[model samples]
Every structure is written in structure tokens, then in C-alpha cells.
Target: MVVSLKESDFFSKNRRALAKWISAVEDRLPEGLEFLQRHYHRVGHAFRIGITGPPGGGKSTLINALLRVFRARYPEETIAVVAVDPSSHLSGGALLGDRIRMDAIGLDEGIFMRSMASRGSLGGVSEATADICDLLDIYGFDRIFIETVGIGQLELDIISLAHTNLLVLSPECGDEIQAIKSGIVELVDIFVVNKADRQGAGRMVNDLEYMLGLRVYSGEDWRPAVVSCVATGGSGEGADGVFELVEKVESHRSWLQARGRWGRKNRRNLERKLRQNLFHYLQREFDFLQPLLEQKAEEVEKKRLSFSEALEILLEEFSRQFSSSLKKRKGG
Candidate 1:
């Protein structure tokens, strides 16, 4: 049986209820949209940070280190993490669940961690990621971290949802200039070089600094800072440069807030979210035109009609049906 949850349950910070609602949203169920609508007013309180990079870039370890720093700095504040993992083809579940990697952090009462499967999203994030972030914000978490699966050229969906986007890199991923060119470098607010203890770390930093120097940013004078860190806290050595990384992130946040860009960014994010939701709704309702669409496809296959011509016919039929439905409603 599908579990039902009330809005009050979410407002009260009930983990079980929150988890169920997130699942519903991930599955694109109507109840989830309803819940989001009910609690829409409570969002925008938490600061969202998106961490993304190539596989083996140590994003998970970096996040784990940052979590420790956040807890120590703000002991009383709540923190939430949404880790996106590749989906398992057989089970359709998160392949690398949060509990397996960040078990220690999950044990903390002040920290809430949930893993979501990318489920074939090319951008290294799930479609429901922004919605889940909103729910966490409404739950009163002071900070929200969205860690995406391994990133590539088109993996820039995080830019639309996060206030600050961190592009993680590693020394072993040699030729930093070539690496940045392959990803969406312009959208990043900060660059983090994890595994700083490895060789070529300094060279990587220099390459990134040189590339960033060529960009001409408008309005504000905030330049993306490159910070080095070994995230594992290995034998009292892994925590190196972590404090600097955290400081740079906080500094960017303050810079955005000072110039009134924070609110503007949030508005832009809302617009993108609304557009995505509308597209999803239209896709869900496509069944109303599916039979006609199939017929149109067959016509195209037989060369009886061009693809564009068939599409036009399909749209005309859809418009007629939509008009009839509206007329019937008015008469009723």
C-alpha cells in the first residue's frame, strides 16, 4: 500500500514522512506535487550548494569533510545532503546509496542524508532534485548539499538549482585546461581540487588560475577561487586546505548576498523549476494524443507524409480535442 502523509508531518520534521514524500516526487506522483504546493511558502531558507565533477574526483569525500566542518562551525544548525547516484538497471535503485559511503555522517541527528538514482538523466542529477531541495529547505535545514553523479559536458543542470556550484577536480586528471574546456566552466562559482596531496596539484591550480584570469565577469568582481584539499582526513593529513575550501564557499555566498544577487538567483531558479514542472505535466498528459501520434509515425515511415507535416496534423487534431473538451466543460 502507498503510504499517505499529511503536510503537518513534513512541517514537524518527520524523517519517515519526508522520505516517502521525496519518493513520491521522484516517481512523479500527483500527491508529491500537492505536498510541494502546500509547503511552497516555507522554502528559500536554506543555502544550496551543488558539488559535481568527473568520476573519482572525490566529490563524496569532499562533501564528507565539508559536513564535518559545518557541524563543528554551526553545532546547533541542521544540514541535509542529497547524493545522486547512477541507477541500477536491474533494481532501478541508487547504485551507491548514501549510507554505504557516508555512514558516520548519517549517524548524526543534526544531519540528514538521502541518496537518489539518476535514473537515466544525462545531467548527472535526477529531475526531482530541485523539489527535494525545496522540501529540505522547508524542513529548516541551514544548508543543503546536492552531490551529483560524475559530470561531463552536458552535466550542468545543477547550475539551475544551486546558489553556489563547485566544480571538483583532482591532480590525477591531468591537463586542467583540457578538463575545464570539456565541462561548463563558466557556470562554476568555485573550483575545488581534491586529493591535493597528490603530484601535479600545484600545476593544476596554476592552470585553472590562468584560465579564469581570461574571463570578463559583469557587475560583481567575484572571481572563482581554486582551493586545494585532501578530503579523507588521512592520518591527520587529509584535512589539509579544507578550511580554505569552506571559507571560499562562504565568501562567495556573502558576496552574492551583499550585491543582492542572491535573491535574483533564487528567482531565476524558480522560473527554471516552474518550466520543468510544466514540461513534465505536458509529457504526462501526452497519452491523450498518443494514438494519433502513433498513426502519424506510421504515415511518416511509409513516406506518405513528412515528419513536420505529420506533426502539424497531430497538433491540429490535439487542438480540436482540447477545444471540444473545453466546450463540454462549459456546457456541463
Candidate 2:
């Protein structure tokens, strides 16, 4: 059975309550939607940061180091992490291996971590990721980190939810640099070259810089910064370059706020969510058209009707049935 919590109980800062709410939201429970509708005003406060990269880029270790640094830097601030892991083909469940590496930082009282299964979402983020982030934001977390499942060059969905997006790469990313130059370069605000202690790290940095030079940027545009980090070893051992990386991230954040683009980005992201919700709602409302669609498809296949004519017929039937349904609901 799903558990439900009162708004007051949720606001009282109970972590277990918060965790239960996350589960409800992920499951799309009615109470979860109700809570979101009630307290949506509490959102838009947390700074959501997205981190993505190819597999074996040391992203988990980097995040572990980041949590330590962030905790020390902002002692009073609460932090939340939503790590999206790839789902199993057989069970559709995630191993959530990232949490193991993050255990040290997870022990901090001010920090909260949740692992989510991508569940066949090719974009590297789960469908509920944005909503989960909003929940964490409403919970009054000062900062939220969304780590995507290992992704390729074109899986750039993180941009919609992230105020600042970091694409983590490593010293062995020479080929990766070439592969993602066309797509990822344009969207990323920061290119984090993790495992900077490895050989060819300097070359990778230079390569990224040279690639940046290839793009034409005006004085006002935010050019993506490439920072190298040796984010190997234990939780906090190789945090040497992370300080600079954090500084660069902060600079980008400041740039966004100074130029008045911060709010605009959030608005755009909200618009995207609205559109997605509308699409889902329409799909549910028009689900009764499935039989007609199948019949029309059969007609087309049998050459009894042209494709365009069949589609027109379906649309007309859809309009008529939709009107009838609305009238019946309205007691007409």
C-alpha cells in the first residue's frame, strides 16, 4: 500500500516523509500530484545542476568529491542528489551502482540521495527526474544535482532541467571529443574533464579549447568552460582540481543571473513540461480512437481508401465523438 502524508508533515522536514513522497510521485499516485499542485510555489528556489557523460568517466567519484566540497563550503545549506541509473533489460530495475561510491557523502545529515532507474528512457534521464527534482526543490534544498545515466553525444535532455549542465569527460576522450563536437558542444555550459591525473589529460583540455575557438561567440554569450579534475581515489582524496571546477560552475551561474537568462531558462523548462503534460492528457482523452485508427489502417492496407482519405475520416470521427463525449459529460 502507498503511504500518504499531510502537507504539514511534509513541511516539517521529515526525511522519511520526503522519501515516501518521492516514491508516490515516481509511481504517479494521485496524492503525489495533489501535493505538487498544492506546494508548487515552493519550487524555483533550488539551483539544479545536471551532470552527464559517457561510462567510466569517473562521474560518480567526481560527484562524491563535489558533495564533500559543497558541504564544507555551504555548511548550513541542504543538498539533494538524484542519480539516474540504467535499468535492467529483464527486470527493468536499476542496480544504482553510483550510490555505493557516494556512500561517504550520503552519510551527511544535510545531504540526501536518491537513485532512479532510467527504465528504457533513451535520453539518459528518467521521465520522473524533473518532477523528483522539483520535489527536492520544494523540500527547500539549496542545491540539487541530477546525474544522468551514462549517455552518448546526442542525449542532451538534461539541458531542459538543469540551470547549469556539466558534461564530464576523461583523458581518454579524444574520440569522444570528435563524436560530440557537433551536438554536446553547443548545449553544455561546462565541460568537466575528470581523471586529469591520467596521461593525455592536457591534450584533451587543449582539444576542447581549440574546439571552442571553432565556434563563433559574441561578447554576451556564455562560452562553455572546460575544467580538468583528478576526481579518482577515495571520496575526497583527489579533490585538487574540483575547486577550480566549482569556481567555474559558479561563474557560469553568475553569468546566467546577471544577464537575466536564469528566469528565462526556468520558464522555458516549465513550458516544456506543460507541453509534455498536455500531450499525455490528450493521449488519454483520445484513447478511444484506437479501434477507429486500426480500422482505418486496415482500409489503407486493403486499398479500400487512400491514406489521406482514411486519416481525414479518422479526424472527422474523432471530432464528432469528442463533441458527443463532452456533451454527455456536461449533461447536454
Candidate 3:
């Protein structure tokens, strides 16, 4: 059966429809792109929070705790979580399915949880992550949390999409300090030291404070807060810091709004999304030239053409074909 976007159920707060639309967008279907384009104006209402750090840093646990706190504090608001995990090499599915750790949140009707595979992307996120976030935003979620796969210095893509970014750290990870030194510290809005009950947690907090002190931040700028938490503990005993974390996130949101930076940030995010979509569209348009590209490769392998010569030929042919197609469309 063909599902039409014109159906009121598709645009309503229907979980099945939302899931179907996300899957279509992930697969890069034309109908999916059209649906998003039609509703582009409805985005930018939700507060996006990004959580990232090294593998086994207890990011999922921290999010689980945060979910409990948020649900308790704002029982009426809706929440959505997008957990990105490393992809399985053989099956191309999320390896860990972090949702398993968030089973408690899954039971809440106000909360929506999705697990996405990184698909071997070095940025710790999949290409369709931003699109999925957009869908969630338009679906009227009050808050959206995106947990990235294990990240490194260059995996800062989350900073562009999230209004506030939390860098999760663990006392058990010996490389925590080293990872911070790799430039990840500069990208985060909050530092969360999970597993505070373990040894070295205080030292990690001190190290982060010292690093922050080195940077000459303006007095008017928002200072990142470093909080400690034992996310795995029950009855909120280990999650004492979750409240402070929520407070800091709210403070940052207020700071951005008061300074008139929220609109600017949303515009910047939209620009990035536009650039990404244009690049992908160009790539799809170039698919027709693949056979010719292979032929050029064969010629180069046989020493009939140099690499540069083959590239020039391909570009010239592509330009000619593209121009002809434009003319045909105009005439028809």
C-alpha cells in the first residue's frame, strides 16, 4: 500500500507514521524528502541536547538518569531520544542497541526512543541523524536528546545540531584526560563525570576546571559546568547530579534566549542542513555518469590516459550532458 503524505494521520502525532517517515528519509526516498520540505517551517521549537564521549563512558546511563529527572519534573512535556551506536560490520545494524539500557524510559508514553547505527561514519553520527532530529522536532517533541557513538576530536558534528552539548566522562576510562586534551573540551557546553563513586572522579573534575581556567572566556559568556554523577545507582541515589545537570541546561537555554543568540544558532543549523542536502542531491544526480567513470578508470589503468586527463574528460562530458538536460526540461 502506498502511504500518502496528504493523510491527516501522517502529519498528526502518530508514532507509526513518524517511524515510517524517518525510515523513508533514512533510505533517501523522494517522497520522504518532499514531506520534510513541506513541513520545514514547523521545525526549531524543540531544545536539542547532544551527548558524546569515548566508548563505555556511561553516556547511555547518564541519559537514562536524565530521563527520569525530566519526566518527574515536567510530567506534561514530551521527550525524544536518538541514540547512535556503532554499526555491526556483518548485519549493518546497531551493535549495542542502547535502548536496552533505557527500558524504563521506553515504558513511558511521553518518551520516544530510537537507536541508529553510525554506519562506520567517523563523525560518530549517521548522515540521516539531522533529518531524524528534524522529524522529531516537527512532531512536537518538547525536548530531544541525541547520544552519539564514541567520539574523537574531529567528531564535533554534534555541536552544529545541538543547542547544548554534554561531554560524558568516566573514572574507569584511563584516557579520559587525554581525550579532553584532544580539543573535545572546547566543543562541549557541559562536562559530566559519570561513575563519580569510582576513584579518580574528583581528579577529572579538577583537571577540567584547570583547563577551563586556561581559556580566556568573556564574563558575559556562559561558563560550562562540570558535574559528577553515579548514573547506575538506584532510587536516584547515584544520580544526585542529574538535577544540577538539568538546571545548568535550562540556564544555558535562558542565556541563549536572553542574548538573542537562539535565533542565530537556529539559522546557522538550517544553513548547515541546506548545504548537506545540496551535496547529497548533487551526488544522486551524478549517478548516471557512473558507467562512464568506470570506463575512464579502465583507460587510466591501461595507460591510455593520465589521471588528470581522465578527470577533465569526465567533467567536460558531465557539463555537456547537464546543460542538455536543462535545455530539454525548459523546452518540454
Candidate 4:
């Protein structure tokens, strides 16, 4: 059942092909890494925007509205969405699948949406999120939206993966906003107050503005902008602040471009990605050392060796084994 897809199949504008590739990547199959190795050069063209916030902040609804606005504004361009949801305890699948929530948008041919389970990652995104986004980028989507599992203050990893980061907050958050101000404030590019029709919406925005004023930007010049939105329809039935929200996001993009920081940020993202992948690669390659590690741990537990002494013995063994394997591989 594991059929190898042709290179053309990946490059062709077929949704089915893209879905297959995404599945492979998420599952961490060898084919997925091979595909990435082959076509990674096709990346860096797509603009990645990350949306994250506290639970019940309407992040999903805001993303839905933003999709509509983007589609209308740029009909010729294609868009991709990667929504990360908390994992189900039993099955480890997405608990609140965004594909269902975004069904109101229907199946627009110009848009691609995929939902992923966070898989217990504390970073608010799954380990494979960046890889999936790279696949979407190589698939030729002009814009990619990454919606994180809403874990409030701990979702700072989005800063490393996205070009523009939007932190969606709501009036309902109340005192929770104070908890977020200490950490999330520094990473966000735009602070979006959704449910702007609510009573405390204005106060929330003002409080955020005041907090921004007190913080020093260090050497950075671009101050995070605060905006309000209802994240519903554009009609009078719901406040249409999403339009302004989109404008602010675009403005941030322009600012990044004008200051020539876009490429620099992208480079940093790649560097971090490379380092993460390297760590995983080493873990997989050295899994055979687990027994030796356990033995060392037992020696330390018995007081036969100190931690440093155990570590030194383990390092010698590791070096000897690794060097022997390298010689064997070269000789063969």
C-alpha cells in the first residue's frame, strides 16, 4: 500500500497529492523526509502567518474570517491553512478538528486546510508543524496560515516559525490578560482583541496599549500593533473588524519588507529548524545506547559511581562504538 509518488505528482496542482504528502510528513515516513530533501529549495516563497492565543479567544473564528477576506482580496492566489488542535487523550487525534469548524467556508478550490493534533507538545504546535508548512510552501501556496493550539502564555514557539505572529485575545479573558502580559507581549507582532462587541473590549485594548508603552523594545523598532475584531460576517449582524485586522497584518508584512528583516527572520527560522532536526536525528541514530545509559543510571543509584564519573565512562563507550561504526561503514 506504500506506493511511491512521482516527482511530477508532487509538483502538479492536485489536492489529493498534497494531502498524501502531508500525511506522510505527519507520520514521519522515510518518503516524507526524502520529499523534503528533494524539494526544500521550493520553500521560502510562501508567507507564513501564525495565529495563537488563550483558549476561547476565537482564534479559529478569526482565521475563518481572515481566509474569506484574503480570498476576496486576492482571487488569483492560493492559500493553505494548518490548524493545530489539542490531542484526544484516547486516540491522540485532534480533539477539536478545525476542518469541521471551518466548514462554513465550504470547499473553496483556492484554499487548502489541514488539522493536526498537538501530540502533547508544550510549544502549542505539533513537532511536524514546520515540516507540514514547508510541504505546503513547496506545493506553491502563496500564503500559509498556522493556527496554534490555544495554550495561552506558553505558546511562544510560534515566534520561531512565523513571519508575522498574531496573538488573538478577547474581552472574556479578563484577568487572564494580566497573566499573558508578562511573556506573550514580547513575541507578538499584533495583538488582536476579538469579540469586540463585548463590554470590556475597549478596556482590554487600552490595557494592552498601556502595557506596550511601558515595555522597552530594546534595539527593535517595530512596535506591536493592537486591533479589535468580531471575527464574524462582514455585515451589520456582526462587527466586521476582521478587515482592519487583516490590514494591520499586511502593514506588519510591509514593515518587515521595508526594513529588510524578512529574509533575516526566515534565515533564523531555518537555522532553528535545522538544529531541531539534528537533535531528532541524533536521538534516532543513538537509540542503541539506551541500555548502556540505564546501566550507568543504576551504577549512580548504587553509589558505585558519581554522575560525572558515569557520564565520562558512557562518553568513552559512545566514542568507541561510534568510531567503530563509522570505520565499518567506510570500509564496507
Q: Pick the candidate with the highest TM-score.
A: 2
Candidate 2 lDDT over 1-332, as tens digits, reads: 64667777778999999989998888788889888888899899999899998887878888888888888888999999999888988876677754876764656899998988888776877777888999999999999999988865535568778999999988776688878856668789999889888899999999999999899999989998999888754435456688888888789889989999899989988887777666656676689999989998999999999999998998898789878878996899
lDDT of 3 by residue, 18-106 (tens): 88888787777888888888898999899999998877788888888888888888999999999888899998789877578785686
The alpha-carbon deviation from the true structure for residue 274 of candidate 4, after best TM-score superposition, in angstroms, is 1.8
How well does candidate 4 match the true structure in TM-score terms? 0.88
Worst 10 residues of 3 by lDDT: 2-11
- What value does the lDDT take at residue 30 in candidate 4? 83
Report the C-alpha displacement of residue 225, candidate 2, in angstroms: 0.3
List residue ranges in candidate 1 displaced over 4 A.
103-106, 175-183, 218-221, 234-238, 283-308, 318-332
Residue 329 error, candidate 3, Å: 9.8
Candidates' C-alpha lDDT: 0.82, 0.84, 0.82, 0.84
Error of 1 at 164 (Å): 0.6
How do all models score by TM-score?
0.86, 0.88, 0.84, 0.88
TM-score of 2: 0.88
Query: Candidate 1 — number of clashing residue pairs?
Result: 0
Q: Which of the predicted structures, 1 or 2, would earn the higher TM-score when compared with the native?
A: 2
